[model samples]
Target: QATAMSVDCLGQRAVLSGRRFLYIVNLDAPNEGHRKISRQSKWDIGAVQWNPHDSYAYYFAASSNQRVDLYKWKEGNGEVCTSLQGHTRVISDLDWAVFEPDLLVTSSVDTYIYIWDIKDTRKPTVSLSAVAGASQVKWNKKNANCLATSHDGDVRIWDKRKPSTAVEYLAAHLSKIHGLDWHPDNEYTLATSSQDNSVRFWDYRQPRKYLNILPCQVPVWKARYTPFSNGLVTVMVPQLRRENSLLLWNVFDLNTPVHTFVGHDDVVLEFQWRKQKEGSKDYQLVTWSRDQTLRMWRIDSQLQRLCANDILDGVEDLIDGISHLPEPDKTLHPQDSEPQHNSGHGDEEALKEDFLNDPLVGKKTDQLGLPQTLQQEFSLINVQIRNVNVEMDAVSRSCTVSVHCGNHRVRMLVMFPVQYPNNAAPSFQFINPTSITASMKAKLLKILKDTSLQKVKRNQSCLEPCLRQLVSWLESVVVRRTAWAFCPTLLSSL
Candidate 1:
């Protein structure tokens, strides 16, 4: 049951390994021009990967038992270029260096990791000795010399220049780590999924504490960052052999999965993102399952938005405005630590009492005083009222609402005070192009103010609630006026 697969970096080809052969299929045309190379091997292929560098796009490596065979496929013909033989036990994983085409690293149960130069396959060019065998290995995408290896529940960071010892150690998980992935943009950041039923994000600079954690009920087989936005894809160990275990999460807010991928009849063995094409907003997720089927899921811009943190964009602008000031304290005190989502939020009142105390809102209150929480609310607000149009500007702390109910068009500007959502309400004022009567306007304004006050007293946002109240009242007033006119006509006819 050899079921290893890898897609080339160019996104043009994919190779799937089986017991008797390696099937190479063109991703652009999966059904045609497919070819297979026969290989006689007793052990299953444990891992396979294509060279990530563009120049070496035709080369790939597959490990069967303890030996890794490097294959070259070009012009519809394929053959084994060379084979590396050093590990005493099964090879667990291998990775091609992101920056170096000639460097390939492999981890094995022999408790030795080898960095081989394909030019000389006689033996490994360098060997790293460890007490426990590594289950996974990956090169840092942002740094050429940095790499990481996972041994049981621990992780070791290494610099290729220093092979004598690991530079840093992280006790990442209590259970065995099943997956490790380095962040696309940051070299210091990485994610690990473990059998402990949790995926934890780590900033390796601070090894003691994790940046965040995503807890699941079942063991996680793999968790990897999306190539596009702030999304993460996780494949959980299937329970009962029929559960839908693939889930997509928004890294910033791990409250719920943004989407779930269905249709895999069996467990997903391997999954990888296709290299994004130039000038395209859509992404393709390629997954291979034990059901013996390969599937591609398309992610459009709309679905991508669910994974984005809208508040971060506005917060970055606020941070830039105060660049001249001294940097904020980097030391994270126990009180200022990250709040775990699974734990109760009873103590969160102290940190979230006001916008100024918000962790993401930042300490630059003197410069902009804008709260990122407000921006996030605007992005997620539902504005589907029948005759209402709202224009919200979180930066200015104001929203303009226009409503049309029967010949009356009311336009008002609602401005929030500085102490908003902390027992301070917004002010509502009617603007030009308002065709409503004085009595109607006064009644509507009173209702809006009361709605805002009720929510603000409880330390909650009031913009969306106020808009909904306005629409509900306006519709009721229109119905009453229509009923009065109909009553007079009915009496005259009788």
Candidate 2:
């Protein structure tokens, strides 16, 4: 199997592809090396390009036989977690719509490019057949609705919202279009690479035009805009070595190459510009070499913001959970056709006026965006947590979580409203833990290791029995339960 080729960072989590598996690292920890998150994958992690949003996110893989599988990495400890299904060939490259989190685009060797509604992993929402030999794909970041692809000798763009070929070109290239990428900050600016040993830039917004071409003797295998940085491009070339080399490009003047990096002897197979933080242009840079090395690069200078096509060093947090934007609802997150632009200049004022009138704006919400309904049910809690012996029994038929804080002799319960008629009241709930996080869980585990418990010892493989016994004793027992109590109020705050 191929060694890990690329690893992309998104805040604490970094998605790594290689060894026929995906590894996610919550790098935010003080000792991230000790914590590992991984899963075997049925997809080929490309030499460059990791998921743009979440670390577990993956769309399309290089086809081993006939079909490419796209997946959403599920982080819980459960079977049937990872979601997959996409293109029918080696998924050469893919990208997700940023503004709309649920949309995915992919291109493959089968000569077909497709889009998916990751919101529903069961099926592909849109599929558009492309030219034969088409093997590259990239989404226009400036316009998530648009996608571009290159095949044997053509470069094409399609409106994802449309079914027919809205934009096409037969005379776009003289040879196979090997690489394609769109500018991160600008919608019209695009870069293309070819087997003809040349890299070219184009501005699609300007009546279908090619801005400039930079000559190169090597095949440009991958190219992309450095996430969040201004006017920077990182390209991977597999010419002299199977590993790869970094080529810096100036989007304003693509005809001239500014810098070429030569650090690895083997093929430099994968490269990713660290996302987040503008000042850390060169910070968090990562690359894989065939020589079995996954090295990190830090920008040498802080004064210089832009160097070559990569940002300067030390900038991080670009992937820190997209700036908390005022979204209408979760529905808009994955399939929002477009964010409603401020109708007039005083959008700020307009939003303030609207927010003041929104009934659910500042209040705690239930599963249906309504106030949490109150009802009582003292039923069974039967959700099992695998080998961990951690389970969430529906203490009642309602949505209530019982958190056991090992120390301080304290336990808290956050319960939600009752399920309504028609199974359609749609009680709004965030399944993600309220008071507990992965990091918090990890810390508690560490504490368990240090504390006195039934199963305390070295190299004891299973802690389920011990943890279950501890949790059973620590559960908060309230005799009389009502909706108007502190438990319900605290539950709604979550």
Candidate 3:
């Protein structure tokens, strides 16, 4: 049976690792069909991964006893290009950098992780030694320099700039960690499965403890976050049964699985979420099992989209329920009752006219209201709002405001409709700090937009949460830069 398997980023091919042969399957033409690449191995192949950057390269790496083999596709055949040798023991796992086409990182039972440049395989360009042998390693999807490794019960986060020491370390599991994967949308969030019969979620920004834990009665062999949703898929080894080991969970609500996939006659070795097809509204999950068979499970669009919003709605409902409880006092102090007024109506009207004349103004609104809910939320946080220009047409409402949070400044254009906090969702866009790279800006906007939409969908004011997240990210960036400045060795090397 194959012990390791991987699907290419493009979802066009899959590679399965067996004892002495590698099976490459053409996903697009399964019947035409599979090819076997022969290799000499004393033990089962440990891991296999395809280059994530360029589909045209068709390059992949497979790890086995003390070595990694790099192969390139030539006329439908995998030709061995190079062999990376460094580990003194069996290699455990490997991953390709999301942004670097030729960069690969492999972990081994020798307590060492090697970073290789596939173009020059004479030796690894960088190496990291851990306290214990590592079982799995993964690269951050959003941050190029950040990577993580799991050894025994500890998970260590490393920044490539400072390879000598880990940036953050935490005792993640009570037993051996079997799988690790980062959240697709959040750079700081990661998930891990363990032999301790549990799955854990962590935010690297908070190193002392995990963000969430999913308890299972059976040993979890693998847990992975879905590509476009907050859902997680886990493969568990049931104590008395081999069937119904695959479960789909909503991260926010772990009390129950949203759905369970049951079909495998034996334990699932590995499972991964395939890339969504263009114009398709659903996602496909592929699983390889000890049954010597592979199966693809299709998740409908409704299930995927429900993950974030449903979780947020549950939170909103809980808050609403708590807020309805009796309070200790009914009377407000005179100081707390002081009236606040809008003082710049004239300037706002002028700005509204200017915005209305813009070519991008697809819709307009005139009935714009500054909800007291938003005002109170902002005041409690002491978030400074500057250059507030409110505008509206008959159909839509919007405002351009500059937020001052400590030393960070963010300018955004917020658009709302009359049914905001009920039926319509708000939009947020960056209007200042045009200096940020396109990729960075896009990620920022995506987080903000998702957050705001979730809030509005719950009929709650969103500006506060959106602004809070932005400020938090900015603060984290500053902290990272400060830490980097103190590493003179890293600075000199760079």
What CA RMSD would you report for each candidate?
A: 15.8, 23.2, 19.5
Could you tell me which 10 consecutive residues in candidate 1 have the lowest summed lDDT? 343-352
lDDT values, one for every candidate: 0.74, 0.44, 0.65
After the best TM-score superposition of candidate 3, give how far the Cα of residue 170 lies from its true spot, in angstroms: 0.4
Candidate 3 lDDT trough over 10 residues, lowest sum:
341-350
Write candidate 1's Cα lDDT for 302-331 as tens digits: 456555544343334333221111113222
Clash count, candidate 1: 0
Q: List the residue pairs that clash in candidate 1.
A: none
- Model 2 residue 401 CA deviation (Å) reads 64
Candidate 3: Cα lDDT at 453: 69
What residue runs in model 3 are displaced by over 4 Å at the alpha carbon?
Answer: 55-57, 310-494
TM of each candidate vs. truth? 0.66, 0.52, 0.62
**Top model by lDDT, which number?**
1
The clash numbers for all candidates, in the given order, read: 0, 31, 7
Candidate 1: lDDT of 231?
A: 82
